[model samples]
Target chain A: MTLKANEIKVGDTYSEEVCRNLSRTQIVQYAGASGDYNPVHTDQLYTSEIAGYPSVFAHGMLSMGMTGKMLTNYVGHGRLTSFGVRFTSQVFPGATLTATATVTGLREEGGENFVDLDVSTTDEDGTEVVKGTASARIDA
Target chain B: MAVDRFPIEAGHVMMFARSIGDADEIYYNEDYARSTEIGNIPAPPTFVQAGAQFDPDYFLRPRIGQEWFGSAKGPTGITQRSGSGGGSGGGGGGGGLHAEQHYVYHKQLKVGDVLSATTKPGKSWEKQGRRGGKLMFSESVTEYRDQAGELVVTATSVGVRTERPATSS
Candidate 1:
């Protein structure tokens, strides 16, 4: 069942696969869709030769968006009161990313119930790529 | 301040979902979406900010020698790294990075809706970095409203910039 405000506990955690593995097509598609054509994201030569990175990386927004998917999938859409994130590390190609959402706090304000969560994304090796928090309104 | 208008289209929504590796048909397939609770293409939560690429004066545009966070420049006036110190190069302020990002969705934005956005700087501060020296941060908030004047979304994003370390003693 979907998580409702009343049923959620402070320590509840949710985890899901966000991306199996990043590919160049998806990265370029993101650049085309989001209008961020930064060479470091799209041009492998620029990343390896100019930027000195082994491989091109995905945009931080891409990871954040994937994490957002985990929240919407579990809590349901339009329930997000607020969401925030910090870019912790770079995500490279062939890296599988999983997003975890942990409820950190619950509070009542102005007769409304809110669930606070610590959200994060990590690669297969457990390197945190993104970390942040989110708040959602649930039925009391 | 003037409001910048951005339109939401089905094609754009589909491409965005695909870009993020989200295969949910609701974002792309109209027939599949018609049966869902939303009954139409549902734009992803962060979709609105994706429209910023179309804004001529997009806030994240890199500036030279300007104090910036979020992948641009900074206040130090030191542009590129001399490669001697533990410095990351982007020419003075060209290499800013995003420190934090926040989004508050007031309503579900659907395809065919046009959003009007107004953005302004929110907070600016500085703090000591553990190793990167002085860190600069700036925050900006963009409020998106639907055609009916209903506040649809409020997005707050923060960026961090670090001064390049000195090369020589």
Candidate 2:
């Protein structure tokens, strides 16, 4: 359902535990679906010996995809007008993540209501992994 | 990356939604989707990134009869190594890493919509890094258009090439 403009305030916030103990299998699933089979995300041997990382890590887009679920759940299906984010930290396997969206502003344009939001996703340690802003259509 | 024919299929949407842990009925249930405001199963906000699947020259996917970069019988499949760093769309062969992604949706992308994408380089810059050495960042803008040639989504992707493999702090 769409958000009612009268029911939401500028400071309203929504959060979700996007993932817990992220798995290498899930990362592979994302790689298959997104068609980004970067060995750094799936091949532990290569990631450690060649890439020089402790282990394979999640694709930044996968984290963003999980975070987008929080936004679409908050704003309603197919209501987003814009969404953006920066990959602040790398997310590795077994990491747990939570995504939050905070309402920052509301406006009316061309007889339509819209909401602006500040979005952030953090790991178990509260390390911000992704941060950005989004805008979505709302019910007037 | 450029794709001449990227069909938004239901099976692909379901798999993508599931991969992201999204259980929304609208993403997979056709009957439920028909009753929604979008009137059909719509792609998730970040779904268009899958356009790489349709890009024949996408380097991330290992080509048949070609040497891959990931581990196989040994630590790596490729024999010779390049000194170049990694960036966006680069995985095993010392390519770049994805730094940032932004999207502006002109309309809801739904199942059955055929999309074509065209990408152009935007800008590039460099900066010294504390851990990964010099960081080279580049931007690319891609436009997705529907069968009618209507722009459906405009995406800007930034990729960073680190002088060395990034370490967790």
Candidate 3:
């Protein structure tokens, strides 16, 4: 039930169109589930006044989650072996977030099929919130 | 969460790794981790959150006793290979939409390295979402300090939440 390496070639793109919008309750829940509760995430006044933000924002991990969705949707679950990323900018709430993955490398090593992906989450203004790479070992 | 009272210890690093489903050798085996560039087991960026350490009352007083849910909380690998929790479509965001996410690693986390983390709400607001749904993003900034109280890592996560659409399921 997993995607094989040969099944995913370079230049493959998955449909990552956002389906539904995220809400406040979900943010609170994520904080609870993830055990993160920085004021910058939940307080608009602090962000706009103290932190110098236009408003509150989404968690960088959430942006990464979107990238994970893109990779999993394309390569399937078990097939994805490693995923990592670096955060570049803040993602404000209500900003349209889009996830995309570009296969940078597809090779065989130690008798394994692997795909190297350059993933990213961008705002409607093309602000890259999270940039990352994901590699998957396709089923033989 | 009794985070500050947990009494951070070197032994707890391994225990934290086990709790988060990360079996990365570097996190569990000090010797193996020492062989890497980090010279020790590097804490997964998001795994740092597991420390549950908070700032002293005199340091960040306004942030004491904040309420936290266990829903959208995700780990951002802080200073090394980082990330955790998987699933597609934010079918479970508590109230905010996931606008963006990113992590910056200043160095590597090693075995026996004791660290502390404190959480605080960033900001909140209302915005119009596509199709008229209410949208918001909640940012949480956690500061990680080493045993010497030196700032080791600073992690900020944003939770973008919007009202679920009223369209057909």
**In the order shown, what is each candidate's alpha-carbon RMSD?**
6.6, 2.2, 13.9
* lDDT tens digits by residue: candidate 2, B6-25: 99999999999999999999
Best candidate, lDDT-wise? 2
Pairs that collide, model 2: B86-B95, B86-B96, B87-B95, B87-B96, B87-B97, B88-B96
Model 3 lDDT per residue over A27-139, tens place: 54444434455545665544444333455566656556555556655764335545666666665556666778887888888988778788877777777767777776666
TM-score of 1: 0.80
TM-score of decoy 2: 0.96
lDDT of 3 by residue, B27-80 (tens): 567677566545655544444544443424321123435432221233211123
Off by over 4 Å in 1: A48-54, A107-113, B1-3, B31-35, B58-88, B91-95, B164-169
Residue B100, candidate 3: Cα error in Å is 12
TM-score for the A-chain in each candidate structure: 0.94, 0.99, 0.83
Which candidate do you rate higher for lDDT, 1 or 3? 1
User: Which prediction has the highest DockQ against the true structure?
Assistant: 2
In order of DockQ, best first, we have 2, 1, 3
Relative to the true structure, candidate 3 reaches a TM of 0.48
Query: How do the residues A27-110 of candidate 2 rate in per-residue lDDT, one tens digit apiece?
Result: 999999999988899998888877778889999999999999999999998899999999999999999999999999999999
Candidate 1 lDDT over residue span A16-104, tens digit each: 99998788888888878887655556666544444444666787888898898898887775578888898888788787999999999
